[model samples]
Target: MRFFKLFFVLLLYGLSLLVLPPVSSSEVVWSISARVGDNVTLPCEAPGVVDFEDVAVKWTRPDLGPDQFVVFYRDGRPDPDNQHPSYQDRVDLVHSQLMGGDLSVVLKNVTINDSGRFECQLIQKMENQKKWSESKPISTIVLKVSDPDPIEARVGDNVTLPCNTSDVVNFEDPTVKWTRPDLGLGQYIYLYRDGRPDPENQHPSYEDRVDLVHSQLMGGDLSVVLKNVTINDSGTFECHLIQTMMFGKRRKRSRSESELLSTIVLKVSDPGSTGNRTETGDEGGHEDRQRHGLTGSVCVVTVLSVGLFLSKKAKLSKSF
Candidate 1:
């Protein structure tokens, strides 16, 4: 019995090494980053202790105050009425996945007015207890304003936008998605991941008209091709990407680091629609348009197309 007891104690001690450490009162762990006026997330992805109904969650902007808060969840409830005035409507919990350690905060309409550091704190106590206990970690959240590159395209025409990465070891897996912000959130004109088109997230209007533009991690080209464009297709397009491991990427990537690159403001314009309409009749249209003296600035052949150009996004992200 004595030997068995000793073995059990030793095993218990060893197992403790595998468990997550208890958070300390001095440490703070929550991160947020964003461009001015852009939505940002301050994530406090830390594991939680389950079944503790009396436990509480608190959010405070340390730079703003010692106890000032954007919001807080306590005693299994939220206190929005008592939330900090400035963050009353802007702060939200994406950390409902907190049980898995995801304590993320999503902030919308991010602007210069929303600049600062955020903290996520966990407090707990039994209903019968009068005192509350709290824990924290070492993490800081910061925000920055970003202006992505602009790309334009036209319907029935091909538009190319690149998802360039600065330094990736090897693109063993690559994903390219073209998004039409005009379609609202979570909408896609075309998406390609791992070199395959994802029909699951396809936009009905883009059916059969989208294709991969081109990709070569070595050169940081992840451009997607959109064909048979439409007027409604014009809007902001973001080039999303993720790195894939390749065989010879180490040495090559060591010279370069894996990085996420994006460009926004992809506009799809109506081709020749902006110009004066020539009477339609293949020969008549062509002859009349010319005879009518339609040329130069008047004939823009205007269509939305996005490519590697001196765009504001590149300048903002310092890609170029």
Candidate 2:
């Protein structure tokens, strides 16, 4: 009888261990960098999760104060009551189905103000009860955002407005658009898609005036060269990179995400004009100094030669 009781207790203990939820022991922190208007994903996962219905995930920025979460997901859906206002409509789970324990969240159109440390926590729902277990942090992500600088060019000069996705490995075959917002809506300065430049929607003013290095597309360089830029070209140029992703159980459905990778302000001015005086004046001043220095050296050499010749003649005459 004593032996049977001991065996029963051991069996119960083993079953309990098998039914208990898994806990993440990792405390690793990840760092990610992005530019303004870029979409970035912060990764988090809970292993051994057989059912997502009983799991709740919360992503919080501690600096935002207590109860202010970047994302609060419960009851198999997002709970927006406690989410921060700034993060509203700008955040979403990478996978709505929570496939393979992936609880990563995507932040879209991020700005510099979004730079901060984010924490992800997992809360386990109690069996046959309305209560939940204490939240356990499983991941930490630090995000940094920055803006691109403006580009300057002179009239009639060929200019390259830079845009690239080379930093992202595996990114391929994305549709690229360069648009000048000041040129009215739906009008683009350049457009490339379907492995070639589609000029059908390009602005008439930019016809035959812009070109992209198609050979470098695979390398992620989407820079466009503007030939003989005019003062009218001076405006904000935005580079949009649109990528299509297929997701779902069968991977049959498709969705597209557009990233505004670069916002460059082009300042085109005539040569030697006041609008470009600062740059042109600096170059002109440098050349003037160089010319003056060369002339001064030549004059010194000529003077010294004349004095030496005169001295030599005087010595010869005296000796004669």
**Against the true structure, whose lDDT is highest?**
2
Q: Candidate 2 lDDT, tens digit per residue, 1-320?
A: 99999999999999988998665577558999987767899998875545777878888987997768899888778999978988887788999878888889999778778998998887778886598776667889999888645578888999888877744633445578899767767788988766677898789989999888654475788788889999998887888777656677785735454556677778887787775778888999999999999999999999999999999999999999
Residue 228 in candidate 2, Cα distance off native in Å: 13
Predicted candidate 1 versus true structure: per-residue lDDT over 1-320, tens digit per residue: 99999999999988886785643544554445565335577766445445446666777776665556777876545678557666765666785535565556777555555666666766678466887765663345665555544566666777665555554434565556666656756767776655677887677888887766554434766667767667776666655554443457464422221222454555777667644344244667678778667654354433222333436567878754
| Shift in Å, residue 268, candidate 1 | 3.0
- RMSD to the hidden true structure, all candidates: 25.4, 11.4
Instruction: State model 2's lDDT.
Output: 0.81
Question: Largest TM-score belongs to which candidate?
Answer: 2
Q: Could you tell me which 10 consecutive residues in candidate 2 have the lowest summed lDDT?
A: 165-174
CA deviation > 4 Å runs, candidate 2: 1-24, 149-320
State the C-alpha lDDT per candidate: 0.61, 0.81
TM-score of each: 0.37, 0.52
Clashing pairs for predicted structure model 2, backbone only: none
